[model samples]
Target: MNVCGLDRWLRILVGIILVGLAAAGAIGVWGWIGLIPLLTGLFRWCPLYAIFGFQTCGLAEQKYGS
Candidate 1:
């Protein structure tokens, strides 16, 4: 396993903020439900990604290659 840097942290933060704000909105959670995806998007470690082999975070191979 590896640790993530700034990009990963930023993604998590953005997810929390957007989801939190949406859940607080007047129109309510019908649309707020969409925030679930945003939340997952922010965190680079998605379960679906693991299944599909899709990772958006900084490249681990690139790090080691350097």
Candidate 2:
């Protein structure tokens, strides 16, 4: 995964919680932004990481498929 195990699970958990809170009207509409982490976790890719040459996949050559 582009993100490490801990990071991936945290993102997914936080994303779901935020979205749930938004849907329940307990938070602002800005909570919808949680989708960023949700999708990135599901897809195992982060655009910011790709752009910044960062990765937590535990492999030196994992970034950009280099």
Candidate 3:
């Protein structure tokens, strides 16, 4: 939830592209790693962000348990 809308969307898009490429055999198995970003984006929780004490969620959202 700490992820901003745009950032989350971008991660989702990139993850989908990478995973799709992997599934299509267009890329190496490494592309499957895209799941990381995909899950993070969908969950709106980033470990790195937490470590860095960063948050992109709106004030209201954050206050409401984002």
Estimated TM-score for each candidate:
0.41, 0.83, 0.86
Per-residue CA lDDT of candidate 2, range 1-66, in tens?
Answer: 477566777889889999999988899898998898988877778999889977667765354533
TM-score of 3: 0.86
As a whole number from 0 to 100, the lDDT of residue 3 in candidate 3 is 80
Candidate 3 lDDT tens digits, 1-66 = 678678888889999999999999999999999998898899999999999999778888777854
Residue 36, candidate 3: how far off, in angstroms? 1.0
Candidates sorted by TM-score, best first: 3, 2, 1
lDDT of 1 at 54: 59
Off by over 4 Å in 1: 1-3, 30-44, 56-66
Better of 1 and 2 by TM-score: 2
Q: lDDT, candidate 2, residue 61? A: 34
Compared with the true structure, model 1 gives a TM-score of 0.41
Clashing pairs in 1: none
